[model samples]
Target: MRGTIHVLNGPNLNLLGEREPAIYGHDTLADVEAMCRAEADAAGYALEFRQTNAEHEMVDWIQAARKDAAGIVINPAAFSYAAYPVLDALKLCDCPIVEVHISNIHRREAEWRSKSIMTQVVTGIVSGLGVHGYALAVRHIAEVRGRTK
Candidate 1:
C-alpha cells in the first residue's frame, strides 16, 4: 500500500519563524519540514513537504494528493480563513486532513484572524503550540493512517 502523508503550507509560511517571532517561534519553515520528515520516518511513513504562496498551486497539490498520499496535514496560514478554491479541492480528496495553526486564532485580534474554513472537514486541528503543533499533527496523521490500514 502507498503510505505517505503530505504536509502542505500556504501563503507567507516560508517566512515562518521570522514572520513574527513572538507569535510563530524561531523555527523556520525549513526547520519544521526537517522535523516533520524525521517524525514521519520514525512513525514509518513517507512525507511530501510542500509550501506555496499561490492559491492555485496549493489547490493543485491537494488534488494531486488524492493519488499520491494517504493523509494530509495542512497549515493554510493566511489562506485558512478565506481561500475557497483551496478548501474545495481539499474536500474532494479522501485523504484525512489535519488543519494546523501555529498561533491560536481564537485568542487573536478582532479583525486580522478568523476560524479555519476547513474546520468541519478536518479530522483534527492543532493550534497555539507554534511549530510543535505541526509535529503533533504529523504524529496523529501517522497513527490514524496506521489504523485505517
Candidate 2:
C-alpha cells in the first residue's frame, strides 16, 4: 500500500440512502464506501472504512488513525455539533484530515446545523456534494499523501 486512509462516518450514516433521499441522495453507505475504495485504489492507497453511532468508538478509531493512517476522511454527522471529545481526538492526528458532509450544512435553515466543531482541526472540508463529498475527501488525502511521500 502506498499509504492508508481511514474513512470514518458518524451516526445515522448507516441509514444513508433510506434516511434522507432528498438531501443526502439515494446512495447507501455501502455505495459511498465502494466509491471511496475506488478513489483510494486509483491513487495507490489502502482504505479502512468504518461507521459507528458511539462517540467513544469513533474516538478510539481516530486515535488509531493517528498512528496507523497517512490521512483521514470523516463525516461526523450529529457529532459535528458539539462532540468535544471527538474534536480532541482528531486534534491528535498529525496527518491530513478532511471533513465531509453530504448536505450543505451552511444552507440549512437551522442555525445549529451550520456549526461544526470538527472544522477546527480538519485540514479541509467537503460539503453539499452529497455522497460525492466522501470521494472528494479520499481523493484529497491521496493527493496530499502522494506529495508527502
Candidate 3:
C-alpha cells in the first residue's frame, strides 16, 4: 500500500514570502504547499502538510506522524536550535525523516542559528534550497520507498 508523507513546518514559516523576501524568497507557504502536493501526487503518496507557530503543537504532530506516516519532511524554523521536545518526538518515527531549511543556516550570522538538533535523528537534510526543498524531500522519501518496494 502507498503511504502518506507528513510535511511539517514550524514557527514563523507561515509568514513566508512577506516575512523576508531576501532570505526566504517570494514564494508563499501556500505556494510551497501546492508544489509539495504536486510532487507527492506524482509519487503516488498522500501528503499531510501542516504549519504551526506553537512548539507543543509541532511535537504533537510529530508524534501523530509516528503512527500514520510513511515518512516525514520537517522545517523546524527557529525550533531547530532549542526544541529538544521536538527532537525527542522525532526519535519515535520509524520511517525516514528529512529535515529542511530554506536558508543556509550555516551561513547565518548567529552561531546558535547554525545548529540543528533534528539532524541527529533525520535521514538527510536539505538546506539553503529555498521553497524547492520541500519538493526535494518528498521526492527523496518517494524514491527511497519505491526502492524498498
Number of the predicted model whose TM-score against the real structure is largest: 2
Cα lDDT tens digits for candidate 3, 1-149: 38999999999999999998999999999999999999899989999999999999999999988976879999999899899999999999989999999999999889998889999999999999899999999999999988987
Q: Write the per-residue lDDT of candidate 1 for residues 1-149, one digit (tens) a residue.
A: 24888999999998887787988889999899998998899998888999999999999999888765878999998788899998889888787889999998889886557667878688889988888889889898888888887
lDDT of each: 0.86, 0.94, 0.93
Clashes per model (N, Cα, C within 3 A): 0, 0, 0
Better of 1 and 3 by TM-score: 3
Regions of candidate 3 where Cα sits further than 4 Å from its true position: none
lDDT of 2 by residue, 49-84 (tens): 999999999999999889769899999999999899
Ranking by TM-score, best first?
A: 2, 3, 1
lDDT preference between candidates 1 and 3, better one: 3
Clashing pairs in 1: none
Residue 120 C-alpha lDDT in model 1:
67
Supply candidate 3's per-residue lDDT for 140. 96
Candidate 3 clashes between residue pairs 3 or more apart in a chain or in different chains: none
Reference-based lDDT, residue 57, model 2: 98
Q: Which pairs clash in the backbone of model 2?
A: none
Ranking by lDDT: 2, 3, 1
Candidate 3, residue 28: how far the Cα is off, in Å? 0.4
